[model samples]
Target: MGHLRQIFLFLVSIFIISTSYSQIEISGQVFDDQDEKLIGATVMVSKDSVSSILAYGISDANGKFKIAVNNESDVLFLKVSYIGFGTFKKTIQNKAQTLEVKLSPSSESLKEVIVKSEILRQRGDTLSFSIAAFKGKNDRVIADVLKKIPGIHIRPNGQILYKNEPIQKYYIEGLDLLEGRYNLANNNLSVEAVSKVEILENHQLVRVLDSLEFSDRASINIRLKKDITLSATATAGIGAAPLLWQTKVTPMIFTKKQQAIVTYQSNNTGTDVSGEISNFTIKYAGVNFDIDKKDWLSIQKVLVPPFSPERWLDNNVHLGSVNILQRI
Candidate 1:
């Protein structure tokens, strides 16, 4: 009891504050049987080794105390030990607030139930996820993050189909990054740098001068991480056949009013360079925006106005040009 008294010193209301999935803070105070707020109560939570400053807190003069966490604290622990009284343990299983803990003098050395112990200082989670959130189990490339988007699809022949057709454009961080032969960007762009995936369906590249003309199509816009937009990426990888040793070097420079992306891809199979330069400044609201039923049927008219038959000798030079841009 002598050493125990030294451990619990004056700590009574022990509170730990932290955040998890969203912005959540965990707080609690401790008091004694006499309703006296315990001061100097010890609280400790072991955080990931990336950094120290784990969960911790103490009590105040009013016989009250508190603890807090700034990050996810699902695995926290709270231990309270004082002299002349037996130590107690509590398990904070989930994120909760307004906790009231009352400690009594030592009657027996009863051990705390591991499951019921509140030693886990805090509880919260901001990012809740599951495997189903991803597009395909075969999403092996960064572009796969885009393909999994609800309205997007990848045609078997290498064409990027959004809402089941050729995509008009592709962008990253609101910057047009690929022009044609997008396989390079799809294969080289790291998904880790993407913060949001936008699927533009029945996309109209131009806002509008007059409703007299219209084109219905789709596109993919990747919102890259802030750090990625202003930098370039050069990747070299060696994989199996169908994809042997290859080098993809893409150097991009972007500014407010202008952007230039130079992509060079080479393999035993093929070699291509895609350069996109435009004075157009891009500003977007969101991807996968829902169009009303009336807008959908109306745009469908512009998209497929009287499909003329394609002869065996019919040349798709325009479609081919669009396909070239899609290959990146």
Candidate 2:
């Protein structure tokens, strides 16, 4: 009786081991009717035609997929599906095999997709704001619309502040063409030419040391519309108090290999248009001699009135500047 019991136990153990290793593997490549490999297709195995999923796999970039399902019965159901493609189903035998599935285009039409633009988006350390969502009808220049964006402030001196702190740098299409004198671009650039504004937080200027160094400074970048490579802004005004006049013309060109900005502004209305060309110093930064000292001294001598500059001060000023950046 003892010998018979040992044999029974041995046979039971063998049966259990064989059942444990009874998983059937199915490997296949999913393709369209045109023989094009369809990536991201869903391949699933089920015990019945409409039962719960037993195993599943997604086609890789090469449109290859592999699924392993337990051999519960002699047959299993396999299903493959992709967007805009008809579903493929088959009664596959519970055995390891490879297959190539070709899915035909679906006869049913999909609903119309209405695409909407995004107002704001954040990816990694960069934040992008769309101009169309923030720009108002009265906004003419890029600076006017920038004020409507949250967490951004434009000072009277044309300095851009992000979150109450001054930005470290300003860029146009990833190029620091204006250097620190970005007020010219900010005030003169047309709102229609710009598509979006991006802020790069924790910006590191040096690309070589990006991994080794970390920075807390933030930078602003202006992106132009695809069709707008050349833009110009001109303003002319004449008032009849004491023959006050102001005129400005700025033409700018941005291309894949070159960028240029030329400006000519003249005014007798005490607007101080020359300030646009002066360097905007950031925190913990200074200039050699403060090139804007003469302009500041003139304002001090006049004892600037509490009212607007166009009302009181009588003066004549002309400013012409040309800035160009060529990529090698």
Candidate 3:
């Protein structure tokens, strides 16, 4: 009986030693196609036939990662993923104790994935529109393209509305080139030059109070194509019967450190050109301004036309504006 008990203890000890020796450690470095170290790459290990994750880690700043597995007999599946790179996958048997992974650039694959996805993508507080998916042959300018976008509308008077409300600000490449007037850029800028349009929802213009203050206002931003550096547009029309004429010339320049837009418009056709250079009231801001203050007491004594003021007034309007923005 004593010998039998001793033999049982010896078998138990050997089983424990074998189990400890079966565990394995995996270590590896991740690199890009150019042999550059890829930091923050995700590394995942799972059973070859199972979908459950066994171990996972992210590559350090040096692109190095390590993970340990208690059951080496189980076939492991490794997956690594990073932005702008194709996913790397491999099946690990007993021989793969260490790994060196090289991820290839996947521009075409990434674009395909994006195309297969939805036309609109909301990340954080920004909503992005894919230009190719929303553009049409009838779209001559940015305004025309915006009219087709979901939750966005362009009025006949050149006002832009998002989610049935007007936006507070309009920007180009992170710069407010139009200040309070965005009609010139939206109506005259070429749609071919634009690559994407982003709406910053719940935006706080002030950076310091962004976290502390909450705002319901949104802003529109235009992103130009990479190859387009400068663009100009000009339109002129004349009518014979009513003797009406209109002309508009807009030139724009965009760069890394600066942006500029110069506009000139003249018309006798009753189109309000001042809307291109002035700021309009945003209803979300709860701001009100009484620009037309007419005293009824004095006007009552004079003979006024019963028609609307706009119909009774007749004048030629001319406007010229230059907006330059510099970024340090």
Candidate 4:
């Protein structure tokens, strides 16, 4: 009887292990017709629920993106597109399991709009928005259009959440800036530079040691336009709470392979106000960020730190805390 019990217990343990773990690692490289790697490509996946992006990522400078999927899916789409290359797509079946895709370039015959519209993405679970979707009625800031995208909610506290999860980071053309703290309602990023705003869900950071895959966490990547301009944007006025004034100016300058991004902002209103500046530069090919983000509340407070005690007590009499939830 004791021996019989041991066999039964073994079977139960096996079942538990099988039921509790169901995941697959999908990894590969992208190459052009001549076999040249295409860097900074976008990749995404979602469940057939049609609800939101389930998994998303971008190819590295070596032209590679990695994603992990679980259980099963009806179909999978793989796409590849570069600035000068044509967009290509393919379909995969569940039975096929692992995959490696190669995207080809297109001729200049059709209109540029048609080419950019699709821009080579996996068709099955990926969702996308055209540049047209971002055009505002008048001079709407970037946050205006972001509010329209499904599965995205710009909170009153100025934090951007995708599928009930706070986006761990933000990047302009794959460059991490301000750590995704101000993406919610602030119009810091110009729609023009944003060739695409990739929402990488369940993103994992890749460990270079080649031995730490099991311990790495998800990360995010942003794809920007091929060429852009140097410009600044400013918005200042008195709102209901922050009765003083607010101003933000960012001087952005870039080259094909280099950039100097500087942000200088100052606000003295009511509940929350301060001055800050940040600048960083990275090689287009050398580095990328893979973050294991935690404690989102701390990050938000840091982004919109409270004003001085004097500022808060002064507003306490009648005015409420400054509501600076619109700009980001």
Candidate 4 accuracy as TM-score = 0.43
lDDT of 4 by residue, 1-328 (tens): 9999999999999998775555655677778778888776666554542334445556777887787665466665544455556665565543324455566666655577365635334332333554443445563555666665545776654556666555555545455445434432245556665555555544443436535444222223445565654545666555555266556556555444554545545455443332121111122364543223333256344343365454453432221111111112
Candidate 2 residue lDDT tens string, 13-56: 99998886697789999999999999877777878785645666
C-alpha TM-scores of all predictions: 0.35, 0.59, 0.56, 0.43
**Can you rank all candidates by lDDT, best first?**
2, 3, 4, 1
Q: Residue 243 lDDT in model 3?
A: 95
Backbone Cα, N, C clashes tallied per candidate: 51, 0, 0, 14
**Candidate 4 error regions (>4 Å):** 1-109, 112-120, 123-128, 180-186, 207-220, 226-228, 236-246, 256-260, 274-328
List CA RMSD, all candidates: 20.8, 19.7, 19.3, 11.3
Cα distance off (Å), candidate 4, residue 311: 12
Candidate 1 regions exceeding 4 Å error are 1-141, 175-177, 210-215, 227-246, 253-258, 267-328
Instruction: Give candidate 2's error at residue 64 in angstroms.
Output: 33
- What local lDDT score does residue 303 receive in model 1, on the 0 to 100 scale? 43
Evaluated at residue 193, the lDDT of candidate 2 is 91
- Best candidate per TM-score, number? 2
| Candidate 2, run of 10 with poorest lDDT | 111-120
Give lDDT: candidate 3, residue 211.
97
**Candidate 3 — which residues are off by over 4 angstroms?**
1-118, 239-244, 281-314
